[model samples]
Target: MATRAELTEIFGAEGVISLPRSEATAAGLSEDDARVLCDVGFPAELPVIFSLDVPGDPSAFSLVPVDTGADITKVLCLGGPSGNSEMRYCLDMEDGYVILLTLGRQPAAEIINSTVDAFVEFLYRYGLRLKHIASADDRQADEYTKQLRQYLAERDPQAFAEEDTWWNMIFDRLLGKEF
Candidate 1:
Protein backbone atom coordinates (compact mmCIF):
# COMPACT_ATOMS: atom_id res chain seq x y z
CA MET A 1 0.00 0.00 0.00
CA ALA A 2 1.22 3.49 -0.78
CA THR A 3 1.80 5.80 2.14
CA ARG A 4 -0.02 9.10 2.49
CA ALA A 5 3.13 10.95 1.61
CA GLU A 6 3.59 8.88 -1.51
CA LEU A 7 0.02 9.40 -2.64
CA THR A 8 0.23 13.13 -2.02
CA GLU A 9 3.48 13.26 -3.92
CA ILE A 10 1.97 11.52 -6.91
CA PHE A 11 -1.43 13.24 -6.85
CA GLY A 12 -0.49 16.55 -5.26
CA ALA A 13 -1.67 18.03 -1.92
CA GLU A 14 -4.59 19.84 -3.54
CA GLY A 15 -6.13 16.54 -4.62
CA VAL A 16 -5.86 14.79 -1.27
CA ILE A 17 -7.56 15.56 2.01
CA SER A 18 -7.07 13.80 5.30
CA LEU A 19 -10.19 13.06 7.25
CA PRO A 20 -10.31 13.10 11.02
CA ARG A 21 -9.52 9.86 12.79
CA SER A 22 -12.92 9.84 14.47
CA GLU A 23 -14.69 10.19 11.16
CA ALA A 24 -12.85 7.29 9.67
CA THR A 25 -13.57 5.11 12.68
CA ALA A 26 -17.22 6.06 12.65
CA ALA A 27 -17.35 5.00 9.03
CA GLY A 28 -16.61 1.41 10.05
CA LEU A 29 -13.41 1.42 8.09
CA SER A 30 -10.65 -1.00 8.89
CA GLU A 31 -7.32 0.30 10.14
CA ASP A 32 -5.67 -0.18 6.76
CA ASP A 33 -8.59 1.11 4.71
CA ALA A 34 -9.11 3.98 7.11
CA ARG A 35 -5.52 4.99 6.77
CA VAL A 36 -5.97 5.32 3.04
CA LEU A 37 -9.35 7.01 3.24
CA CYS A 38 -8.38 9.43 5.95
CA ASP A 39 -4.94 10.19 4.66
CA VAL A 40 -5.50 10.21 0.92
CA GLY A 41 -8.97 11.10 -0.17
CA PHE A 42 -10.16 10.40 -3.72
CA PRO A 43 -11.16 12.86 -6.39
CA ALA A 44 -14.65 14.34 -6.71
CA GLU A 45 -15.52 12.66 -9.98
CA LEU A 46 -14.18 9.28 -11.05
CA PRO A 47 -15.85 8.47 -14.33
CA VAL A 48 -15.89 4.80 -15.39
CA ILE A 49 -14.68 4.05 -11.86
CA PHE A 50 -16.82 5.79 -9.22
CA SER A 51 -17.69 9.15 -7.74
CA LEU A 52 -17.02 9.48 -4.06
CA ASP A 53 -19.80 10.16 -1.64
CA VAL A 54 -19.44 12.90 0.91
CA PRO A 55 -17.18 11.97 3.76
CA GLY A 56 -18.74 11.36 7.21
CA ASP A 57 -21.98 9.98 5.83
CA PRO A 58 -22.68 7.24 8.33
CA SER A 59 -24.80 5.40 5.82
CA ALA A 60 -22.02 5.49 3.26
CA PHE A 61 -19.75 3.07 5.08
CA SER A 62 -20.40 -0.37 6.56
CA LEU A 63 -20.04 -4.09 6.00
CA VAL A 64 -22.26 -5.11 3.12
CA PRO A 65 -24.35 -8.26 3.47
CA VAL A 66 -24.05 -10.80 0.70
CA ASP A 67 -26.71 -10.67 -2.02
CA THR A 68 -27.42 -14.40 -2.05
CA GLY A 69 -30.20 -14.09 0.52
CA ALA A 70 -28.02 -16.17 2.77
CA ASP A 71 -26.64 -14.04 5.58
CA ILE A 72 -22.93 -13.53 5.18
CA THR A 73 -20.53 -10.68 5.78
CA LYS A 74 -17.99 -10.21 3.03
CA VAL A 75 -17.35 -6.75 1.58
CA LEU A 76 -17.30 -3.32 3.19
CA CYS A 77 -18.94 -0.36 1.51
CA LEU A 78 -16.45 2.41 0.97
CA GLY A 79 -18.86 4.93 -0.46
CA GLY A 80 -22.30 5.30 -1.98
CA PRO A 81 -23.10 4.47 -5.59
CA SER A 82 -21.74 6.78 -8.25
CA GLY A 83 -24.32 9.14 -9.82
CA ASN A 84 -27.77 7.48 -9.83
CA SER A 85 -26.46 4.04 -10.71
CA GLU A 86 -26.58 1.07 -8.35
CA MET A 87 -22.93 0.26 -8.84
CA ARG A 88 -20.76 0.95 -5.75
CA TYR A 89 -17.09 0.47 -5.11
CA CYS A 90 -16.18 -1.49 -1.98
CA LEU A 91 -13.30 -3.12 -0.23
CA ASP A 92 -12.79 -6.72 0.72
CA MET A 93 -11.91 -5.96 4.31
CA GLU A 94 -10.20 -9.25 4.89
CA ASP A 95 -7.78 -9.00 1.99
CA GLY A 96 -7.89 -5.27 1.28
CA TYR A 97 -8.94 -5.88 -2.33
CA VAL A 98 -10.96 -3.25 -4.16
CA ILE A 99 -14.31 -4.50 -5.49
CA LEU A 100 -17.32 -3.26 -7.40
CA LEU A 101 -20.88 -4.06 -6.35
CA THR A 102 -23.87 -3.87 -8.65
CA LEU A 103 -26.94 -4.01 -6.47
CA GLY A 104 -29.34 -5.19 -9.16
CA ARG A 105 -26.89 -7.39 -11.06
CA GLN A 106 -26.49 -11.17 -10.91
CA PRO A 107 -22.90 -11.10 -9.74
CA ALA A 108 -23.08 -8.71 -6.83
CA ALA A 109 -19.40 -8.04 -6.32
CA GLU A 110 -16.51 -8.05 -8.74
CA ILE A 111 -12.88 -7.62 -7.73
CA ILE A 112 -11.37 -4.54 -9.33
CA ASN A 113 -7.89 -4.33 -7.89
CA SER A 114 -5.59 -6.12 -5.46
CA THR A 115 -5.52 -3.31 -2.89
CA VAL A 116 -6.79 0.15 -2.03
CA ASP A 117 -3.43 1.60 -3.02
CA ALA A 118 -3.63 -0.08 -6.40
CA PHE A 119 -7.12 1.29 -6.96
CA VAL A 120 -5.94 4.80 -6.10
CA GLU A 121 -3.04 4.33 -8.44
CA PHE A 122 -5.47 3.33 -11.18
CA LEU A 123 -7.48 6.50 -10.58
CA TYR A 124 -4.39 8.67 -10.60
CA ARG A 125 -3.23 7.19 -13.87
CA TYR A 126 -6.53 6.98 -15.76
CA GLY A 127 -8.90 9.45 -14.12
CA LEU A 128 -8.42 11.87 -17.01
CA ARG A 129 -11.28 9.98 -18.63
CA LEU A 130 -13.62 11.92 -16.37
CA LYS A 131 -12.51 15.21 -17.83
CA HIS A 132 -11.81 14.29 -21.45
CA ILE A 133 -13.88 11.32 -22.62
CA ALA A 134 -16.86 12.27 -20.49
CA SER A 135 -16.95 15.58 -22.30
CA ALA A 136 -16.35 13.93 -25.73
CA ASP A 137 -13.10 15.76 -26.16
CA ASP A 138 -11.35 13.34 -28.45
CA ARG A 139 -8.17 15.34 -28.75
CA GLN A 140 -7.67 15.72 -25.03
CA ALA A 141 -8.70 12.12 -24.45
CA ASP A 142 -6.05 10.96 -26.91
CA GLU A 143 -3.40 13.03 -25.22
CA TYR A 144 -4.40 11.84 -21.75
CA THR A 145 -4.46 8.23 -22.87
CA LYS A 146 -0.97 8.55 -24.29
CA GLN A 147 0.26 10.12 -21.08
CA LEU A 148 -1.41 7.43 -18.96
CA ARG A 149 0.13 4.63 -20.98
CA GLN A 150 3.56 6.19 -20.77
CA TYR A 151 3.14 6.76 -17.03
CA LEU A 152 2.13 3.19 -16.32
CA ALA A 153 4.93 1.77 -18.42
CA GLU A 154 7.50 3.81 -16.55
CA ARG A 155 6.01 3.43 -13.07
CA ASP A 156 4.80 -0.16 -13.04
CA PRO A 157 5.10 -2.35 -16.12
CA GLN A 158 3.04 -5.24 -14.76
CA ALA A 159 0.20 -2.94 -13.75
CA PHE A 160 0.37 -1.24 -17.13
CA ALA A 161 -0.53 -4.52 -18.85
CA GLU A 162 -3.15 -5.62 -16.32
CA GLU A 163 -4.87 -2.23 -15.97
CA ASP A 164 -5.30 -1.88 -19.73
CA THR A 165 -7.19 -5.18 -19.90
CA TRP A 166 -9.14 -4.60 -16.69
CA TRP A 167 -10.26 -1.06 -17.45
CA ASN A 168 -11.38 -2.03 -20.95
CA MET A 169 -13.69 -4.75 -19.63
CA ILE A 170 -14.91 -2.72 -16.68
CA PHE A 171 -15.61 0.40 -18.71
CA ASP A 172 -17.51 -1.59 -21.32
CA ARG A 173 -19.83 -3.00 -18.68
CA LEU A 174 -20.25 0.33 -16.91
CA LEU A 175 -21.24 2.05 -20.16
CA GLY A 176 -23.62 -0.79 -21.11
CA LYS A 177 -21.94 -1.13 -24.49
CA GLU A 178 -21.70 -4.49 -26.21
CA PHE A 179 -18.32 -5.30 -27.62
Candidate 2:
Protein backbone atom coordinates (compact mmCIF):
# COMPACT_ATOMS: atom_id res chain seq x y z
CA MET A 1 0.00 0.00 0.00
CA ALA A 2 1.11 3.57 -0.62
CA THR A 3 2.20 5.54 2.40
CA ARG A 4 0.75 8.87 3.51
CA ALA A 5 3.92 10.69 2.44
CA GLU A 6 3.62 9.37 -1.10
CA LEU A 7 -0.07 10.27 -1.24
CA THR A 8 0.68 13.69 0.14
CA GLU A 9 3.21 14.15 -2.66
CA ILE A 10 0.57 13.36 -5.25
CA PHE A 11 -2.59 14.88 -3.78
CA GLY A 12 -1.36 17.23 -1.08
CA ALA A 13 -2.26 16.79 2.58
CA GLU A 14 -5.53 18.71 2.38
CA GLY A 15 -6.72 16.73 -0.60
CA VAL A 16 -6.49 13.43 1.30
CA ILE A 17 -9.30 12.68 3.76
CA SER A 18 -9.39 9.92 6.33
CA LEU A 19 -11.28 9.01 9.48
CA PRO A 20 -9.82 7.87 12.76
CA ARG A 21 -9.61 4.12 13.51
CA SER A 22 -12.60 4.19 15.83
CA GLU A 23 -14.72 6.08 13.35
CA ALA A 24 -13.65 3.91 10.42
CA THR A 25 -14.49 0.73 12.33
CA ALA A 26 -17.75 2.26 13.50
CA ALA A 27 -18.37 2.98 9.83
CA GLY A 28 -18.10 -0.82 9.20
CA LEU A 29 -14.62 -1.21 7.78
CA SER A 30 -12.36 -4.02 8.96
CA GLU A 31 -9.36 -3.22 11.14
CA ASP A 32 -6.97 -3.94 8.26
CA ASP A 33 -8.99 -1.79 5.88
CA ALA A 34 -9.29 0.99 8.41
CA ARG A 35 -5.55 0.95 8.99
CA VAL A 36 -4.79 1.64 5.34
CA LEU A 37 -7.40 4.42 5.18
CA CYS A 38 -6.32 6.06 8.42
CA ASP A 39 -2.64 5.69 7.65
CA VAL A 40 -2.57 6.93 4.07
CA GLY A 41 -5.82 8.80 3.64
CA PHE A 42 -7.52 8.84 0.23
CA PRO A 43 -8.24 11.39 -2.43
CA ALA A 44 -11.33 13.58 -2.08
CA GLU A 45 -12.26 12.92 -5.69
CA LEU A 46 -10.92 10.85 -8.46
CA PRO A 47 -12.73 12.88 -11.04
CA VAL A 48 -14.82 11.20 -13.77
CA ILE A 49 -15.06 8.28 -11.40
CA PHE A 50 -16.04 8.92 -7.76
CA SER A 51 -15.61 11.16 -4.76
CA LEU A 52 -14.96 10.42 -1.08
CA ASP A 53 -17.58 11.37 1.54
CA VAL A 54 -15.98 10.54 4.91
CA PRO A 55 -17.70 12.24 7.80
CA GLY A 56 -15.80 14.95 9.65
CA ASP A 57 -17.24 14.20 13.07
CA PRO A 58 -18.50 11.27 15.13
CA SER A 59 -22.07 12.57 15.41
CA ALA A 60 -22.40 12.41 11.62
CA PHE A 61 -20.83 8.96 11.40
CA SER A 62 -22.95 6.00 10.40
CA LEU A 63 -22.42 3.02 8.14
CA VAL A 64 -24.95 2.71 5.36
CA PRO A 65 -26.48 -0.70 4.84
CA VAL A 66 -27.34 -0.55 1.17
CA ASP A 67 -30.25 -2.19 -0.65
CA THR A 68 -28.00 -5.11 -1.53
CA GLY A 69 -28.42 -6.26 2.09
CA ALA A 70 -24.74 -5.53 2.48
CA ASP A 71 -23.14 -3.01 4.82
CA ILE A 72 -20.84 -0.48 3.20
CA THR A 73 -17.95 1.60 4.39
CA LYS A 74 -18.92 5.10 5.43
CA VAL A 75 -15.90 6.43 3.63
CA LEU A 76 -17.71 5.83 0.38
CA CYS A 77 -18.76 7.59 -2.77
CA LEU A 78 -22.42 8.37 -2.20
CA GLY A 79 -23.62 9.54 -5.59
CA GLY A 80 -23.20 8.83 -9.26
CA PRO A 81 -20.50 10.02 -11.58
CA SER A 82 -22.01 13.48 -11.43
CA GLY A 83 -22.82 13.22 -7.74
CA ASN A 84 -26.58 12.88 -8.41
CA SER A 85 -27.67 9.30 -8.86
CA GLU A 86 -27.85 6.43 -6.34
CA MET A 87 -24.58 4.90 -7.48
CA ARG A 88 -22.01 4.30 -4.74
CA TYR A 89 -18.50 2.93 -4.30
CA CYS A 90 -18.36 0.90 -1.15
CA LEU A 91 -16.03 -1.51 0.57
CA ASP A 92 -18.07 -4.56 1.44
CA MET A 93 -18.20 -5.04 5.19
CA GLU A 94 -17.93 -8.81 4.92
CA ASP A 95 -15.08 -8.80 2.44
CA GLY A 96 -12.60 -6.01 1.95
CA TYR A 97 -13.34 -5.77 -1.76
CA VAL A 98 -14.43 -2.44 -3.11
CA ILE A 99 -17.80 -2.73 -4.84
CA LEU A 100 -19.45 -0.31 -7.23
CA LEU A 101 -23.11 -0.54 -6.37
CA THR A 102 -26.08 0.90 -8.21
CA LEU A 103 -28.83 1.02 -5.62
CA GLY A 104 -32.12 -0.76 -6.34
CA ARG A 105 -30.20 -3.00 -8.73
CA GLN A 106 -28.16 -5.15 -6.42
CA PRO A 107 -27.26 -7.50 -9.25
CA ALA A 108 -25.37 -4.70 -10.93
CA ALA A 109 -22.80 -4.38 -8.19
CA GLU A 110 -19.40 -4.45 -9.87
CA ILE A 111 -16.30 -5.39 -7.96
CA ILE A 112 -13.99 -2.43 -8.21
CA ASN A 113 -11.00 -3.98 -6.46
CA SER A 114 -10.02 -7.36 -5.10
CA THR A 115 -9.00 -5.71 -1.86
CA VAL A 116 -8.82 -2.30 -0.24
CA ASP A 117 -5.03 -2.35 -0.54
CA ALA A 118 -5.24 -2.77 -4.29
CA PHE A 119 -7.75 0.06 -4.43
CA VAL A 120 -5.48 2.39 -2.49
CA GLU A 121 -2.51 1.52 -4.67
CA PHE A 122 -4.59 2.21 -7.77
CA LEU A 123 -5.62 5.58 -6.41
CA TYR A 124 -2.06 6.49 -5.57
CA ARG A 125 -0.63 5.43 -8.91
CA TYR A 126 -3.45 7.04 -10.87
CA GLY A 127 -3.13 10.32 -9.03
CA LEU A 128 0.63 10.32 -9.50
CA ARG A 129 0.28 9.79 -13.25
CA LEU A 130 -2.39 12.42 -13.51
CA LYS A 131 0.14 14.87 -12.15
CA HIS A 132 2.63 13.77 -14.78
CA ILE A 133 0.02 13.84 -17.53
CA ALA A 134 -1.03 17.37 -16.66
CA SER A 135 2.32 18.78 -17.76
CA ALA A 136 2.88 16.52 -20.74
CA ASP A 137 2.08 16.94 -24.41
CA ASP A 138 -0.81 14.95 -25.93
CA ARG A 139 1.54 12.18 -27.02
CA GLN A 140 3.02 11.94 -23.56
CA ALA A 141 -0.42 11.97 -21.99
CA ASP A 142 -1.51 9.03 -24.11
CA GLU A 143 1.66 7.13 -23.32
CA TYR A 144 1.37 7.84 -19.63
CA THR A 145 -2.26 6.83 -19.53
CA LYS A 146 -1.42 3.65 -21.39
CA GLN A 147 1.38 2.90 -18.96
CA LEU A 148 -0.88 3.54 -16.00
CA ARG A 149 -3.47 1.14 -17.40
CA GLN A 150 -0.81 -1.51 -17.86
CA TYR A 151 0.37 -1.01 -14.30
CA LEU A 152 -3.15 -1.34 -12.94
CA ALA A 153 -3.75 -4.53 -14.88
CA GLU A 154 -0.54 -6.06 -13.61
CA ARG A 155 -1.10 -4.91 -10.07
CA ASP A 156 -4.71 -6.01 -9.74
CA PRO A 157 -5.93 -8.37 -12.43
CA GLN A 158 -9.26 -8.96 -10.69
CA ALA A 159 -10.16 -5.30 -11.04
CA PHE A 160 -9.65 -5.48 -14.82
CA ALA A 161 -11.03 -9.01 -15.16
CA GLU A 162 -14.24 -7.93 -16.89
CA GLU A 163 -14.81 -5.65 -19.87
CA ASP A 164 -17.38 -3.66 -17.94
CA THR A 165 -15.25 -3.32 -14.85
CA TRP A 166 -14.89 0.10 -13.25
CA TRP A 167 -11.16 0.35 -14.03
CA ASN A 168 -11.78 -0.39 -17.70
CA MET A 169 -14.57 2.17 -17.81
CA ILE A 170 -12.28 4.62 -16.07
CA PHE A 171 -9.61 4.18 -18.74
CA ASP A 172 -12.12 5.12 -21.42
CA ARG A 173 -13.08 8.18 -19.42
CA LEU A 174 -9.42 9.12 -18.99
CA LEU A 175 -9.09 9.27 -22.78
CA GLY A 176 -11.79 11.93 -22.74
CA LYS A 177 -9.74 13.80 -20.13
CA GLU A 178 -12.63 13.71 -17.72
CA PHE A 179 -10.24 13.73 -14.74
Candidate 3:
Protein backbone atom coordinates (compact mmCIF):
# COMPACT_ATOMS: atom_id res chain seq x y z
CA MET A 1 0.00 0.00 0.00
CA ALA A 2 1.23 3.43 -0.84
CA THR A 3 0.91 6.21 1.71
CA ARG A 4 -0.60 9.54 0.74
CA ALA A 5 2.88 11.02 0.81
CA GLU A 6 4.19 8.34 -1.52
CA LEU A 7 1.18 8.73 -3.79
CA THR A 8 1.67 12.47 -3.79
CA GLU A 9 5.31 11.98 -4.76
CA ILE A 10 4.39 9.51 -7.50
CA PHE A 11 1.54 11.59 -8.91
CA GLY A 12 2.67 14.89 -7.48
CA ALA A 13 1.27 16.21 -4.18
CA GLU A 14 -1.06 18.54 -6.02
CA GLY A 15 -2.55 15.52 -7.76
CA VAL A 16 -3.35 13.79 -4.47
CA ILE A 17 -6.12 15.00 -2.17
CA SER A 18 -6.52 14.02 1.46
CA LEU A 19 -10.22 13.94 2.41
CA PRO A 20 -10.55 14.62 6.10
CA ARG A 21 -13.62 13.65 8.16
CA SER A 22 -14.51 17.12 9.43
CA GLU A 23 -14.76 18.57 5.95
CA ALA A 24 -16.63 15.55 4.68
CA THR A 25 -19.14 15.37 7.55
CA ALA A 26 -19.79 19.11 7.68
CA ALA A 27 -20.81 19.12 4.03
CA GLY A 28 -23.30 16.30 4.58
CA LEU A 29 -21.97 15.17 1.21
CA SER A 30 -18.95 13.19 2.20
CA GLU A 31 -19.59 10.67 -0.54
CA ASP A 32 -20.12 13.20 -3.29
CA ASP A 33 -17.34 15.46 -2.14
CA ALA A 34 -14.99 12.53 -1.85
CA ARG A 35 -15.44 11.62 -5.51
CA VAL A 36 -15.43 15.09 -6.94
CA LEU A 37 -12.51 16.25 -4.83
CA CYS A 38 -10.55 13.16 -5.73
CA ASP A 39 -11.20 13.75 -9.43
CA VAL A 40 -10.23 17.38 -9.21
CA GLY A 41 -7.10 16.68 -7.15
CA PHE A 42 -5.41 14.36 -9.66
CA PRO A 43 -2.93 16.21 -11.82
CA ALA A 44 -4.07 16.71 -15.38
CA GLU A 45 -1.98 15.63 -18.41
CA LEU A 46 -0.26 12.76 -16.65
CA PRO A 47 -0.77 9.00 -16.43
CA VAL A 48 -0.76 8.02 -12.77
CA ILE A 49 -1.96 5.32 -10.32
CA PHE A 50 -2.38 5.41 -6.51
CA SER A 51 -3.67 3.19 -3.66
CA LEU A 52 -4.79 3.69 -0.05
CA ASP A 53 -7.16 2.26 2.58
CA VAL A 54 -9.98 3.81 4.61
CA PRO A 55 -9.70 2.34 8.10
CA GLY A 56 -13.32 2.82 8.95
CA ASP A 57 -16.56 1.71 7.31
CA PRO A 58 -14.91 -0.09 4.38
CA SER A 59 -11.97 -2.41 4.88
CA ALA A 60 -10.05 -1.92 1.65
CA PHE A 61 -9.99 -0.31 -1.79
CA SER A 62 -8.67 -1.16 -5.33
CA LEU A 63 -8.12 1.44 -8.08
CA VAL A 64 -7.93 -0.13 -11.54
CA PRO A 65 -6.38 1.74 -14.41
CA VAL A 66 -8.98 2.92 -16.90
CA ASP A 67 -8.85 4.32 -20.41
CA THR A 68 -9.92 7.85 -19.51
CA GLY A 69 -9.04 8.90 -23.03
CA ALA A 70 -5.79 10.83 -23.49
CA ASP A 71 -7.30 13.59 -21.41
CA ILE A 72 -8.07 12.52 -17.87
CA THR A 73 -9.26 15.52 -15.96
CA LYS A 74 -8.54 14.02 -12.53
CA VAL A 75 -8.81 10.96 -10.34
CA LEU A 76 -11.66 10.75 -7.80
CA CYS A 77 -11.48 9.61 -4.19
CA LEU A 78 -15.02 8.30 -3.92
CA GLY A 79 -14.87 6.56 -0.55
CA GLY A 80 -15.61 8.21 2.79
CA PRO A 81 -12.83 9.57 4.98
CA SER A 82 -10.88 7.24 7.19
CA GLY A 83 -11.81 7.08 10.91
CA ASN A 84 -8.33 7.83 12.10
CA SER A 85 -9.34 11.47 12.57
CA GLU A 86 -5.92 12.39 11.27
CA MET A 87 -4.14 12.44 7.93
CA ARG A 88 -6.25 10.51 5.39
CA TYR A 89 -5.19 9.25 1.95
CA CYS A 90 -7.19 9.00 -1.27
CA LEU A 91 -6.21 7.85 -4.80
CA ASP A 92 -5.10 8.71 -8.36
CA MET A 93 -5.77 6.87 -11.59
CA GLU A 94 -5.53 7.00 -15.37
CA ASP A 95 -9.23 7.63 -16.04
CA GLY A 96 -12.57 6.06 -17.12
CA TYR A 97 -12.89 4.04 -13.88
CA VAL A 98 -10.37 3.78 -11.06
CA ILE A 99 -10.22 1.00 -8.47
CA LEU A 100 -10.59 1.72 -4.68
CA LEU A 101 -9.10 -0.05 -1.66
CA THR A 102 -11.34 0.52 1.42
CA LEU A 103 -10.87 -1.23 4.77
CA GLY A 104 -13.17 -0.71 7.72
CA ARG A 105 -14.94 -2.42 10.61
CA GLN A 106 -18.44 -2.51 9.18
CA PRO A 107 -20.97 -5.03 7.98
CA ALA A 108 -20.39 -6.52 4.54
CA ALA A 109 -23.79 -5.47 3.20
CA GLU A 110 -23.23 -1.84 4.14
CA ILE A 111 -19.85 -1.70 2.48
CA ILE A 112 -21.17 -3.24 -0.74
CA ASN A 113 -24.11 -0.87 -0.84
CA SER A 114 -21.86 2.13 -0.27
CA THR A 115 -19.44 1.02 -2.99
CA VAL A 116 -22.32 0.45 -5.39
CA ASP A 117 -23.56 3.91 -4.54
CA ALA A 118 -20.15 5.47 -5.19
CA PHE A 119 -19.72 3.70 -8.51
CA VAL A 120 -23.28 4.51 -9.54
CA GLU A 121 -22.90 8.14 -8.60
CA PHE A 122 -19.69 8.35 -10.59
CA LEU A 123 -21.33 6.81 -13.64
CA TYR A 124 -24.43 8.92 -13.35
CA ARG A 125 -22.38 12.10 -13.25
CA TYR A 126 -19.97 11.05 -16.02
CA GLY A 127 -22.46 9.13 -18.21
CA LEU A 128 -20.26 6.05 -18.22
CA ARG A 129 -21.12 2.38 -18.38
CA LEU A 130 -20.77 -0.04 -15.49
CA LYS A 131 -18.69 -2.89 -16.81
CA HIS A 132 -17.77 -6.00 -14.85
CA ILE A 133 -14.53 -7.62 -15.91
CA ALA A 134 -13.66 -10.93 -14.32
CA SER A 135 -10.85 -10.97 -11.78
CA ALA A 136 -9.73 -14.41 -12.86
CA ASP A 137 -8.73 -12.97 -16.20
CA ASP A 138 -7.17 -9.83 -14.74
CA ARG A 139 -4.36 -10.19 -12.26
CA GLN A 140 -4.73 -6.57 -11.20
CA ALA A 141 -7.31 -7.51 -8.57
CA ASP A 142 -5.04 -10.08 -6.97
CA GLU A 143 -2.02 -7.83 -7.01
CA TYR A 144 -4.01 -4.93 -5.60
CA THR A 145 -5.53 -7.02 -2.83
CA LYS A 146 -2.15 -8.32 -1.75
CA GLN A 147 -0.79 -4.80 -1.60
CA LEU A 148 -3.83 -3.54 0.32
CA ARG A 149 -3.57 -6.29 2.92
CA GLN A 150 0.09 -5.58 3.46
CA TYR A 151 -0.78 -1.95 3.90
CA LEU A 152 -3.55 -2.54 6.49
CA ALA A 153 -1.48 -5.11 8.35
CA GLU A 154 1.01 -2.39 9.00
CA ARG A 155 -1.49 0.29 10.02
CA ASP A 156 -3.88 -2.05 11.81
CA PRO A 157 -1.59 -3.96 14.14
CA GLN A 158 -4.55 -5.87 15.54
CA ALA A 159 -3.73 -8.48 12.96
CA PHE A 160 -6.61 -7.99 10.49
CA ALA A 161 -9.26 -6.54 12.82
CA GLU A 162 -11.69 -5.79 9.99
CA GLU A 163 -13.86 -8.88 9.40
CA ASP A 164 -12.58 -12.13 8.05
CA THR A 165 -8.98 -11.64 9.03
CA TRP A 166 -7.73 -14.00 6.36
CA TRP A 167 -9.99 -12.95 3.50
CA ASN A 168 -9.86 -9.27 4.39
CA MET A 169 -6.13 -9.63 4.77
CA ILE A 170 -5.88 -10.83 1.17
CA PHE A 171 -7.10 -10.02 -2.35
CA ASP A 172 -10.74 -10.83 -1.62
CA ARG A 173 -10.72 -7.59 0.38
CA LEU A 174 -11.54 -5.65 -2.77
CA LEU A 175 -14.35 -8.00 -4.00
CA GLY A 176 -16.19 -7.42 -0.70
CA LYS A 177 -17.47 -10.34 1.36
CA GLU A 178 -20.96 -10.36 -0.16
CA PHE A 179 -19.60 -10.55 -3.67
TM-score each candidate. Answer: 0.61, 0.79, 0.26
- The total number of steric clashes, by the backbone 3 Å criterion, in model 3 comes to 20
lDDT of 3 at 170: 28
Greater TM-score among 1 and 3 belongs to 1
Cα lDDT over the full model 2:
0.70
lDDT of 1 by residue, 67-122 (tens): 44765656666654456356667777767777766666365666666677677666
Top TM-score model = 2
The 10-residue segment of model 2 with minimum total lDDT is 53-62
Candidate order by TM-score, highest to lowest?
2, 1, 3
Tell me model 3's lDDT, rounded to 2 decimals.
0.35
lDDT string, candidate 3, 1-179, tens digits: 23334335444655454445554444343454454444333222121111234344322232223233565333333444334322222234322232333333431111211232233322222111111223234466545445545654454334344564432522353445452
* Cα TM-score of candidate 2: 0.79
Q: Please, what is the whole-model Cα lDDT of each candidate in the order they appear? A: 0.59, 0.70, 0.35
Clashing pairs in 2: none
lDDT of 1: 0.59
Those runs of model 2 whose alpha carbons end farther than 4 Å from true positions after fitting are 53-61, 67-82, 104-107, 176-179
